[model samples]
Target: MLRRSAYKNLQQRASQLQLKRSASQSVASIYFPSEPTAPVLKTESIPGPKSVELNEELGKVFDNRAAYFVSDYKQSIGNYLSDADGNKLLDVYAQISSIALGYNNPELLKTAKSDEMASAIINRPALACFPSAEYGQVLKDGILAAAPKGMNKVWTALSGSCANETAYKAAFMYQAQKKRGSLDFTHEELSSVMENKAPGASDSAILSFEKGFHGRLFGSLSTTRSKAIHKLDIPAFPWPAAPFPKLKYPLDNHKHENHAEEDRCLGELEKIIKNHPTDIAALIVEPVQSEGGDNHATPYFFQGVRDICTKYEILMIVDEVQTGVGASGKFWAHEHWNLTTPPDMVTFSKKFQAAGFYFKNPDLQPAQPYRQFNTWCGDPSKALIARTIYQEIEKYDLVNKTQEVGDILYKSLDTLLSKYPTKMKNLRGENFGTFIAWDFTSVLERQEFLDTCRQYGVNIGGCGDSSVRLRPTLAFGEEHAKLFLGIVEEIFLKLYK
Candidate 1:
């Protein structure tokens, strides 16, 4: 019999061989054959002179305060982002997690070039009133096919914030209808609505958790409790926010304590739902709380939330905008919870290239036709692209493969972070695919680390006050993960040690 060390060495070697074998067949390779194998640093600094000049020119007409660099999209490919300076950086941020397949994916370009796409773009239909002949098939074959379990209907919107705001409208309308109970609107109700008063304009609210970020729009901003800057100087709705669990690091080491913390937060949530001044028609929550530090709670906490929503008869919405489309090791992050009842609506946008909410209940559709109406209700071009993305994901099984790659990345990161425990801490998102994040000692440290990362030819992003997050595209594979790990470890050793 071989010794334990020999067996472990053999296992490691086998894993390396497997990774190399899969690299040739990776989705990135299949789609982006011309993708760069490693980052190309041509300039001493990121946002080099050419990028700075272009951005300065762009700033004359547009707000480019937050611009990292002027990107050359034509030159960008696969998991790499190219700047005006002709420097190609390994982009784990992936345009803030929106690129599903990759930059300039051939299949997406094919869809863009098709006659149907050109027609959709040139003669964009006002979808609600003049939906194209292929609209139903488009929904059926694409977005609806990828819907979360127990969801079959979709109300498409223009963006993530729009998707959330529309979902709120649906919830408010559904609840109002239930209260109306077959009665027609009274003259007083009709007249009061013009004044934006009660009995017409709803006093109902949407409940979200602390450290949660829904969006920056008027209605969604009320539910967005992530940052003061986003909400400052904006008139926000008087909505309620409940506590989200503050789980400890290395979750396995603090299981009992974390459970207690989650329960406490759940209790507070129940109290808020029962006692808020306004009716909470719906409660929206992010699975990983992306913008708010990537906070995570166990399935127990989510299941508890599901139970609470059921008891209160309030709609439960899962905001999968950042965690959706196979990034979380599942098509939807809520799929990890295995809730007894599915979320009332699941909102998606970022990666899918289309924004919408998925629901099963017919009641969610407003009683009046134009109640949910708008010009250009949804973009057909985006829908066509979403269809291609769905087909590709299904054909390639990217979700499961993402999980395998994430497992390897997370374990390697865990080992790396252990060497600098104080410098980096609270690593989270285990078993949640590539949807991973961790915190630094302070906000400055995190920012410096991000700046250092970009300087090293790897573009990453930060979330919340003091956390670094990895929002790699679904096309990311073991090869990409290894490169990323190596870069990060090198940076950590140089800076922290």
Candidate 2:
């Protein structure tokens, strides 16, 4: 019935569809040959009897109040997470965005079982005092290999909080050394330091933006301005907080307004820096404020901040704890900014399985030894895991793959969200790989949505007040995205229809 040309066009279209399907299957199978084709729901609810019982038992010895369900790590694979209830859910949260690779990745399993890993875990040298000879090669192959542009050195730490805290220490020390300038410590400085006074302790502060979430440690907590629940009764420093831009969504529609908002925020930041009582040694910021909210600003905004920091001689620290390791379409989220120079220090953790700050300035390191000393400088075991993660990411070209999947996912979400503008709004992370999010109309609605998602076998997570974020693993393919989108549509229909 069709003309020859039309028939040929149909055939070509069929061939292209087949190729796409085959590519999706190939990538998924390469990472997880045994991965489930779709999520398997076995329980009536997420914490069905078995999970509830296990959580109750876990609570006896640990704080299980936050446990969504008792995870069965052994049965989890690829983009799926298994629970004690024998339900397999698609895990977009990815252990709070820490799991770089999918669950029980064979390569990671092999690394875990290797003799070198075993030796590093059991013989665990105090890295600072006596690092193993292999540590250098391990770092070179893994962490250093993935260092952001203009960064060649690293100071490994224990966690995200520790990384930021250590970077703060470096900033303060660097600033103090510059002030001291070839002069040895005075007797007054030495005596005042013991009393925790200004001459020795220094009155420098680290400035952070409002709604920023750095960490919970003493120094880092002082800079955290996210939630009161996290800070509570704890003592905090008097560091000033600067306002971050609150840009409107559908960025294209509000380009002029967004640009104006950013300029206002930049102006406010400069004013804060100028008026702060103590010298602001550093300014720590997240590329995308994850915990505070999945807030974002344009490259122009970040460039402005960079210029201001340079002009003020204050160190700029980019906290990439949740936005690093290929989730942001780039290895480092700040790469999107394309500033004239890189941040003075970039801190990373979560997905990398290791925590540290990368710096190019050697002066960031203390002039005297033992000044930055710790018992275990960093764990070689985590470094080994980080190496495997980096190797696997490179071997699979996962960053580009994630970017491809994110493009498809973002487009799909844009179309889906158009019909439910009242129920959901402020869709973000358009080209930011899989680090996307959308906000619900109310906190209760968001909670219901998250709860309903689990009821349908999807383990999702929320941030800020009422935002759902997608933090899927690098192995999350087009197939996973398709399945997730379908599940989300079903949930939306059931809730809003």
lDDT of 1 by residue, 198-236 (tens): 899999999999999999899999999998999999998
Over 4 Å off in model 2, which ranges? 1-26
RMSD of each: 5.8, 6.3
Among residues 3 or more apart in sequence or in different chains, the pairs in candidate 1 whose N, CA or C atoms overlap within 3 Å are none
Off by over 4 Å in 1: 1-25
Model 1 vs. true fold: TM: 0.95
Candidate 1: 10-residue stretch with minimal lDDT: 1-10
Evaluated at residue 133, the lDDT of candidate 1 is 99
Q: Give the Cα lDDT of each candidate.
A: 0.89, 0.89
Backbone clashes in model 2, listed as residue pairs: none
Candidate 1, position 191, lDDT? 97
